[model samples]
Target chain A: MKCPQEFVFAANYLADMARSRSLEFFRGEIGAEVKADTSLVTIADRSVETMMRDAIREWFPDHGIVGEEFPVHNPDAEYQWVLDPIDGTYRFAAGHPQFGTLIALARHRKPILGVIDIPAMDERWSGAHGWPTVHIRQGRRSEVRTRSCTAVKDATVFFCSGIMWRNDPMAVWNGMHGVNRLLDGDSYSYGLLSSGFADVIVDSGMKPWDFMPIVPIIEGAGGRVTDWQGMPLTLDSGIEVVALGDPALLDDVLRRVSAA
Target chain B: MKCPQEFVFAANYLADMARSRSLEFFRGEIGAEVKADTSLVTIADRSVETMMRDAIREWFPDHGIVGEEFPVHNPDAEYQWVLDPIDGTYRFAAGHPQFGTLIALARHRKPILGVIDIPAMDERWSGAHGWPTVHIRQGRRSEVRTRSCTAVKDATVFFCSGIMWRNDPMAVWNGMHGVNRLLDGDSYSYGLLSSGFADVIVDSGMKPWDFMPIVPIIEGAGGRVTDWQGMPLTLDSGIEVVALGDPALLDDVLRRVSAA
Candidate 1:
């Protein structure tokens, strides 16, 4: 199934914006302004989101927009674009090179395309529904897929500590007993999971913008991404989610976490 | 008090040998050999450890040698040299460029000096007891310090998955929740905490070589490195450890995890 041309074009354009932002950030001229929540924000986040939102308005005026820095542009539209201008802002602010800009396109309440651009790291990942995922590194593009490691004992779990688990924590903890390790970061964890470095990623307390872009990227890489209850992720959902290279492991994790 | 001249010379020579090994593994000519545990153990691990161990035997005959690859020599000596030939072996094998060689000196059952060398990444970190910690990035040396973020809520927490936390999942999981985010890899995470980019790193199930080099490095950077109960990190404990910028936060984390 071919994705709409606009999705491809917009994703590429966003990647270009990320490159420029990364260059500016490393040049050490701009300061990171603190938001009320004490998390750092920068001019790049605002500028990139503005550029992306403007392009969406011009090319798909009927589509909606939801971003970390901005309110909804058209909350009722069937087609929407979600943007996390800088997903690893803390890492970025601290001069670490693990941050990325995330974007995803949804059609009729489902994500059809996604992009994660880490310009400083010189890596880019893009995918659309039903199409093979692609990674661009050092000006070369290659297909991407998650590894199908079956046993929890062999699995490397990527996790972030900020979110609370409503469940008992014992089952998830027990299931984790089988894991090799757990990493953190919301979308970046998905990036690594899709790249075959990790098998499972569990996260909680996500907004639509935080998760929508990651679903297609992992799904396109031959993995399953769903809410904690094992429900498929949708553009409207704001729930806990787990992405896994194998579907059976996802079930195992869910059973363990639910039991906990 | 100034560190002994012999200790500095020995560490520098070992660091040089470690660099050569890292270069070989990263350059990819020899290729990595997988260990029985499924982790990669390349020729670099063997070659570097051999070079360092040989030097210690010839130059410091009375000292014990505890390393990643070889059996301990003179294990009952008053001074021991601990080694991790290549700390992030997985990253080195996969060409991730974040791996480092770890070397530590312990006298009278306590770490006296530590050195972490990552030749591929062009970074070096070293410290001696009562001496200033130093970070050399791209060949420039700067004094390193722990980050000033004192509260657990305000602190950035890092963990190396459930590998270290397997013994007490609830304690580890709950301790993880006490920090801001969870990052991985004992070698690199400890380096980041010492450099002030992160605060509060905890690891369980660590080997002597894995945890020894990190103790002096973090403590010399004005942070505390101790077992989960806030005691000092001695050699080969294979127990849980916590490294924090503030003593109060460390106590809080230990209390939370112990209760869990």
Candidate 2:
């Protein structure tokens, strides 16, 4: 399904608004509170999501909204917007610039457009169905694509926090041996993969608002996003996610992780 | 021991030159090759070191020069400059902006001045003996001090990489439980600790060029830098290093890691 350019434009505008709102509270004294799920939430997260929600409502009254910091709205609508106003809240609260705003437009539960905006770094990546993934950094824009890697052993893999995989830490730890692995890129890891700099990313304990926005960006960049069992990610997909810059290494990676 | 203002000025000048040289190859087609020790090295690393070394030789010919990409120069001199032309080479080669240039001036084997320059991020952090640590970002300069976190369990810790701790991975991993731990910040992690954003850092397999530069920066910021055994880091300290924003937490952290 091709995503209409109008939806893509709207997503970018929403992301721009989110970036502005989030930056206002960045590096300041934020009153961060622990959410019910044990995750951190700051005023920036709530403010950005609220701002984006208002704009989405004003522009597309019937469209649904699913956000990290807010309850779902218009859940039965045919078009839905998924937002994670601030993806890496811990990093943001710690004054790291890698945290980003994630935006995705889903049609009938399928994400057709996605945006990853890193405001502090002045970098933004956007992708839509049937359109090339584009990255804009410091006012320069360029199309991006994933590179090809045929084997798991040769892949440069990124895994978000080992503690996130508490249920099966050793499985990932043992499986990722012999591969060039780096820990903790969070959402930015997917952006690196989409730009052909990282080969694979294995992350767990992600929510819909966290994983939905990257699906189109990775797919449009010629990569693959799936569960550890090699199933496509959807609005209701499980938390254990694996992304591959080169789709050919999926089976090898799956086998390695499962056998561990 | 007070660091001479001239040495600090020279260190910053070297860091500035290194940053410019490294940025030229960043995100470009870098021909990265594996060193004999299995670490990756690129033209940017060698080029930056060469530029810095040349400047150092011309300005202070009697001073010793030790760099990651080259052999020691004037090793017997009282004033020695330690340089890691490009720290976090893996991230740099992957087009990630977290890589940085580290420069430190040591007198009688004690690091008296240090600088961490992240070219892509346009951020620089510098410190000297008896001087407050300062951070410069996009031309804004401010003195930085480490925040107070007195307990190991409550500390925000940054570890370099798990694979580097192949000797005792479980010791560090099990010890870090219940803390806000992040993996892979390299030299930038110490900068964050100095800026009061991070509280602790545990790393292993560090060379002199990697660890020497951070000692003064952390010390000047009201933090402590030492080996895992709590001994002060010297020119010949062991590869295992630990940094704490609050000196009060050292015993707790050492006990935790040792007990693990």
Candidate 2 whole-model C-alpha lDDT, 0 to 1 = 0.82
Candidate 1 C-alpha lDDT tens digits along A1-260: 56787678777886786568655854243422221123235566787778778878987889899899889889788778888888776656544556778888887778888998876667788888878888886688888887777776766676554343544443454557745544454666677677666677777778777788888888899999888788888876866888887777876778755665
Worst 10 residues of 1 chain A by lDDT: A31-40
Scored against the true structure, residue A193 in model 2 reaches a CA lDDT of: 88
Q: Comparing to the true complex, what docking class would candidate 1 get?
A: incorrect
- Give the TM-score of chain A, superposed on the true chain A, for all candidates in the order listed: 0.89, 0.94
- In model 2, where do residues sit more than 4 Å from their true spots? A29-40, A162-164, A167-170, B30-40, B162-164, B167-170
lDDT of 2 at B189: 79
Docking class of 2: acceptable
After aligning candidate 2 to the native by TM-score, how far in Å is the CA of B51 from where it should be? Answer: 1.9
What is the C-alpha local distance difference test score of each model?
0.72, 0.82
Instruction: Considering only chain B, report the TM-score of each candidate against the true chain B.
Output: 0.89, 0.93
